[model samples]
Target chain A: MSAALFLIALSAVLALGLGVYAGRGREMGLEQWSVGSRGFGAVLVFLLLAGEIYTTFTFLGASGFSYGLGAPAYYILAYGTLAYVISYFILPPVWSYAKKHSLVSQPDFFAAKFDSPALGVLVALVDIVALIPYLVLQFTGLGIIVQIAGYGAISKDVAIIIGALVVTAYVIVSGIRGSALTAIVKDGLIIVVVVFMGIYLPVHYYGGIGAMFATLDHAKPGFLAFPASGQSVSWFVSTVLLTCLGFFMWPHSFAACFSAKNRSVFRKNAILLPIYQLVLLFVFFVGFAAVLQVPGLKGAATNMALLKISVAAFPPWMVGIIGATGVLTALVPGSLIMMSASTLFARNLVGFVRPHASNAQTVMVAKFTVPVVALVAVYFTIQGSSTIVALLLMGYNFVTQLFPALVASLMKRNPVSKQGAFAGIFVGVGTVVFLTLTHQTIGTLIPGLPEMIRDLNVGIIALGLNLIVMVAVSAMTPKTAMLPAE
Target chain B: MKNIRLLAILPFIGMLAGPILHNGVEPYILGMPFILGWVVVWILITSAVMAVIYKYDPANAEGDEP
Candidate 1:
């Protein structure tokens, strides 16, 4: 076997071992398994949240985005920093509520807060639908990472199967704790590898970062900045705002807050996480470096720009290290996604249906659901054909529909009736599905609009419609008394 | 406390100002594209702003625990 494949296999084994070991000696109750018994300190919570944030998406998609689309990729950095800023205010209340009620999943928070199990089921459905695509994106990134870095000895399908199995195994055994442990190693390796490649490539190729930008700008004028039409400035601003609202709406991220020891853990992380987001600048640098050095990577293949450039620039052993890092990137977040989805499926969807299932029974259902979810994601990764960025955007459009209802329920009076929350999510998600399937955008839906208005993200339209319907429906319905969170 | 919490809005303005103020590529700030540099600066400013809010927000007071 080549050194690259050997290193990847070794790291996969290490990840599996560490993951299984994390659950050792602890009773794996439903809460213990899903939220680390709600006892994580600031550092672990930080790593867990950061682990979800810097997934294969950050490792590959960010660079590939900058490599393919230029200035549009800057939205990745902008949205995340804003998301952290929003998190500072929102997460404390969420943490306290979840702690007060021992909420294990994102839907649990919604169901309990709205006093409606049907709304929980609605949120669960949206969560699963949105999360599967995101999980598939991670598996696809793993497939690409291994196929390229392993010198093409393994096919993409085989790599995905192997990755899915390893993630499923650890997640079933260790749950969220396992993901958190592996996240420490994953973050450390990714920081070193991304920073080294980001700086080294620019300096090596064109003498320095400044000189590299100068060369690229002269060679391809207007390529590094957003144009006036598609992917324009309006698109960037709207996308950043939409994703900021939707960031914590992600089920794993929402549930991850339930794992923190105190409300202060979130406050501290909000201060620190944006600094962590700055590391993505190196990811963009790597992408920019690839644009000049190893050009001609178009479409979905642009996701390979980071790995391709690294393979060309470094030797086998070095590429092996990078490949290992990529594997951890996919596994850490993939496991968390799987964990969250299964818990949501079992605790909210199934438990709602049965209504009398014991806690241990629910945990069993979650454990069994993990491999099933993994299999579904693996099948989609093999069959699906969109770029990683496209896949993530599709998921975001669906998931962001939950934002309005979530924020409304957090208010002191909880103005939105349960029926209103249901209608809002239904209409919002329906709009996303309709627009996505019809291949329509703001430009096509309404003609004669200016370039700026036309360029706004379609998700913003869904969110706007969602708010209007929610308010309208709530105004017509009898007010539901707000439940005391304490 | 409410006024102090409003400090978080600064990041939203700083970042979303990209299109209006920092859309060009003429003046590369520290070897990066102009918009990219604008974002990097705001990221730092966001951190500093959040740190200030964290210091004074009454939610973090010693007796604030529920």
Candidate 2:
């Protein structure tokens, strides 16, 4: 076998081996399969959370955006750090409530907190819709890595199929623990590979990082700074603020919070995660390095910068290692996200419909739904969309609409009734879809707005409208018995 | 401790303000580009500030068991 094939096979075996090994002597109970039975310490929880947040987007998309769009890419680093700071306050409360009520999913948190099965069902449906495109993006990313690394020996479609099967199988057998174990390997490799390319490419091409930026400064002018055109400062601000709020709104992220042993786990993570975010800076270095060396990669081709640089600089074997790292970056997070969506469907939606369902039955439904979700994602991936980062942003936009309702649910007097919450979500998600479909930029729906307002991210706009509707509707509706006395 | 809940907004301000206030390429600090250096500094400061707030926040009282 060629070195690429051999290394790819080695990565496959390593992922599968670690995945299966994690399931040893453990029962496939719903709790164990979903949240690791709430037994994870700080280190394991930290890795799992980091692995979930840092996906193909971190490994490929951030660099691609930096190489292509310039200053807008900084939002990736800004959001991660801000999100962790937000988590220091938000996650512990949610975790405390989740632990108190045995909530295993994001929808479950909403349902129990607000005392509305209907609201829970709505949250579940919206989450699944937002997440399917995200899953498809992962599959597409894996296909890119495998196809590029295969060098025409293996087809992209077959590689994607094999990749999907590996993730689904390990998730079925080992559950979240499999994702966590593989995450350990995935993260270790990612750090080494990214750090190596980060340092190597810059020094080899442009003397050093400072020299790379200095060269880009002279060659490309404002490319090293925020653009004075198109994406304004407000866009950067709103994107960071909205993403920080929406970070934990993803079902899998909320579910991961429950896996921590205590609130202190989250507190500890908040402090160190910013330091972990330093990894993205290294990824940024690679993008800057590529800007001068590998110029003229247009559109979707820009996503190939890191890989192109690695392939050009390293031997086939080393390139294989980088390629495998990229594949695992997609696989580990893909499994966790698939599992989270399935849990939302099985526990939140199905259990709502079938209140008499047993834990065993719920576990079966969850396990069964995992592959089906993957299949849907695979179907979309085969069709292929070049909007991987856009899909992720859309996901965040719709999910962050839940922030007001979530805050209300945790309040002493949640004035927002279930009716208000449901209406707000529909409006929020609807607005996101409408704006995205129409190709309308943020703060521009009204037309003739100043560039500052027009430059804000659409998610923040949708969220603003959603919050308004929530407050207005709640004020008009009479409180049900479920509403606490104020 | 009384106003520690307000600390959450600081990271937002720190992160978003970089592009608005200092979107220049000059004055590179510690070998990083200007905006990149600004972000890294805020990230470290955010961590330190959060750690300080975590120590003082009453929600994290050692005896408070969930």
Candidate 3:
């Protein structure tokens, strides 16, 4: 009956209830499960996409980076805004294509557009592998939130198992609608918590925002600004560009584009989503406040700075609310991507293997795979918790290689042949994995690289190689005259 | 509207150029340091720019379907 446990129980029950409510009266179809019947309004789509945006990485890791890495953390805010800007151009065409073709997932889009089901299967395989670490990242963050909230009475392992079970059950029963419904509540709590933490913490401890910056400036000069050192300016620019390209490539976000009511909904979201990016500025504020208040937090301990400061400043009940917010941050996105990943596997990959599967059978397979995928993520979370963010970045790197293929299919003509696209993706993702595993600098993979290439993100290097191979191979293939799909 | 796609690059400039131009923490604006302040300004400017494109871009004129 303690405050922490009470708040935890309350939020869990509320989330489950919302999940069940969202599923009521909706027919059980692949379209319903994957795209929420393709009937959601601008507000619903906004909430769903926003739910995917403000994950534990945003709430916890954003602040952690601010405390630990300083100015490099602004890349989070920059990338988000740029993503919305890019979405203005990318998503409308994608939405109309999916609507016209009755596509349900990323691989579905690729399969139909490229007129190659084999490529669809390949895309599905790559995306599902990329998503596993992402799922692990969320569950690991969820366990940390729960354990901290319980004041160490509850262990991280038990919390992670319980969280995985709850999320799997809700997603299996309600699918993406469950995620959208829970997002409304989750975003509401996040707004209040972010505003409170942003303003109150800075003012209470350091007198005001201006004063806090002044003190930090004196203590650690250039900490509030981007360092021209190891984390260089080129790193910032390339990271921002790479993230913007890969943002919507996440299966869940790409699928949410199909759920939009119309093309205008995406345009409106592009205009409105920047307002949401403002929230990260406040989250950054929370991290800056923690820098001096809670010093010397090393390694995994840095991720706890925001929470530790909140517990010290606020009452246990309020701290519990913050804890619940953190849990939802992980749970909502975790449920969503799991649903998307499972549906992708069932529809695209499994369908390729079986060659004859009904829509009803595919839906059943998607539901059945939820717990299997959840348990795999749970295994990874327990084995390797600290590398969650690195895993997420690796996912982004692999997913961004899909960007060129997407652009070719979405915008270009027969300039990119199927063979070219396939080879490009293989080489691009292979380079990323190899460079990452060998711990080689992406820009300096080859000796005597230019400063621009050396300081840039490795993902961008792989993307460049991807585009080059795609174009070169396409030009070598025989030309075929054909009308555009649109 | 044919040129609306060009507006996409505006955010890249606002986000990328700010650090290369004013990476130092001086000339605080509205109580925020210069580099951080540049990001905030661009977020606002990107919204306004996208709003302009949305107004002229005819892709969404088809209206909502039931």
For model 1, how does the per-residue alpha-carbon lDDT over B23-42 read when each residue is reduced to its tens digit?
78978888888898989999
What is the full ranking by DockQ, best candidate first?
1, 3, 2
Best by TM-score: 1
Tens-digit lDDT track for model 3 on A71-180?
88888888889899888888888888898888999988877777778878888988998899888878878887888877877889999999998899889878788888
What would the DockQ be for model 2?
A: 0.70
| C-alpha TM-score for every candidate | 0.98, 0.96, 0.97
- What digit string (tens of lDDT, one per residue) describes model 1 on residues A1-486? 999999999999999999989989899999999999998988899999988668888889999999998899999999999999888878988888988988999889889988899999999999998899899989999999899999999999999999999999999888889888999999999999989999999999988989988898898888789987899999999989998889989999999889988888888888899999788999999999999889999998899999999999999989999999999999988988998999999999999999999999999999999999999999889986764345567778878898888888878888999989999999999998888878789999999999989999988889999999999999999766778756
Model 2 interface RMSD over true interface Cα atoms: 1.5
| Ten-residue region with minimum lDDT total, candidate 1 chain A | A384-393
- RMSD of each predicted structure: 1.2, 1.9, 1.7
Residue A411, candidate 3: C-alpha displacement in angstroms: 2.1
Question: Considering just chain B, what TM-score does every model have?
Answer: 0.85, 0.86, 0.87
Better of 1 and 3 by lDDT: 1
lDDT of 3 at A339: 90
Error of 2 at A356 (Å): 1.0
